[model samples]
Target: MKTDILKFQNLNPEKETQISNLFKQLGGEKKQIPLKEVLEEGNHITLAYCEHNDQVVGIASMCAYHVISGKKGWIEDVVVDEQFRGQGIGRKLMEKLLEEGKKKKLTEILLFTEAHRIPAIKLYGDLGFKLKESRIYTLKMP
Candidate 1:
């Protein structure tokens, strides 16, 4: 399968629908991202997608920011279609994110993965990500 990494730009409704499905494959709740707003506004959010035969098969996003120390990039929402898994699509998506980080001169990149996602964890390790002994906290706002 031929795969190409695409940086999201000038998105339309059709591509938006495909991205919604891709997120579902990652077990994310189905919701539409405000693509136009995101692209038009400078929020430092970048989305990379893996396309095969003009169809999106995988996606990954990065939120980069300037910190007191320096610039940092956080990877999020990486997922490949079930049928396309193990074909290096996810890896390509991540490579795109890394390339973006490099271009932005990010001081560090970080991501969190579930412990049960063994394959994903292995992939992250191969990409030179090390497990940091840090606690994660979250809260849902009403």
Candidate 2:
């Protein structure tokens, strides 16, 4: 059966729960934000999700913002269900998000992934993302 990818702005309760579970696959010990907050981050964020048989099987998100460099987008939290991996759902969701970025006329789109996530890195590279030279640092806020 074919899966459908849609923008995840307004979601019903059942599909919301399914999408929450799907997000857990990406973050092992990372606490999930409440589903309401997840979907309500801001108008700058665009989320794309794919569902199979009414169950959300994949999700990808991008945030577009204007900075000194110009309008840019940052892709984040892209994941596909284990069973659905390699079926092109992730790519389609990303394509949808990139389409959104183009519609907004973003100057550049950036994303970060651990070197250990080889398949994901490959996918990003195949989608025309380059390995950037800058080192990333994060500080946890309490």
Candidate 3:
């Protein structure tokens, strides 16, 4: 499968649609991200995706931030179409994210995946991510 990584300058309507579809595959529901959010560039966000035959088959995104400690990259929303899994597309997406991290000079990269996602956990491990002994807490506002 051919994996064409998208350049920010090349983003357009059609490609955005493909990306939204890929996110649906990840979230298991139709919750389209606004173009405004997807287009956040500079130090805030960078997105990477693999396109095959006019369709986005895999995608990953990162948020770059600078705390008092150091600059960091947080990986998020990684997903590959079920039919396209095991073809190294997910790996490619991750490599793209890491490559971006390097370009951004991030001090560290972090990601969180569900414990049940065994394959994803293994992939993250193979990519040199260690299991950090920490708890994730969340709160929703009404």
Candidate 4:
């Protein structure tokens, strides 16, 4: 059977609850921030889908930043409904984000995925991302 289509659009601030639900389904640990806070931060972009039944099925968020070398973008959270995983929805979402990054003249884009997520790593590699041979360290501040 043909899968329903996927479309990308800017997140509607009013749909924050739905966005939070999607993130929760994906096992994200971050607290849900208000949409107004996201807009005020001026760095994040959240993309969502409108399924055939007019329901939302996926969400992806990115943040753009300027570094000493040039502009860069980071993919923060990307989740497709569990029922929709095998469809091309995730790929389309990522393509849309990359296109936006390119339009803004970003020099690089980066994201991190757990080592066990081989499919995701393959997808990123197919889209021309390289595996950086370096360690990533993080510290949480209270």
lDDT per residue (tens digit) for residues 1-142 in model 4: 2222222334464455666677777674677676556655353554434353555567676678888989988886777778777787778778878888887789999898888878778888988999888898999779
Q: Over 4 Å off in model 1, which ranges?
A: 1-9, 28-32
* Tens-digit per-residue lDDT, 1-142, candidate 1: 4434333455878877788778887774535566665555567888888777777888888899998988999998899999889999888888888998999999999999999999999999999999999999988666
RMSD each, Å? 2.0, 2.1, 2.1, 4.0
- The candidate with the higher TM-score, 1 or 4, is 1
Write down the TM-score of every candidate: 0.89, 0.89, 0.88, 0.82
Worst 10 residues of 3 by lDDT: 27-36
Candidate 4, lDDT over the whole model? 0.69
* Each model's total of backbone clashes: 0, 0, 0, 0
lDDT of 3 by residue, 1-142 (tens): 5554455677888878777777888765336667556665654777777877777788888888999999999998998988899988889889988988998899999999988899999999999999999999977545
62 in model 2: Cα distance from truth in Å? Answer: 0.6
lDDT value, residue 68 of candidate 2: 96
lDDT of 2: 0.82
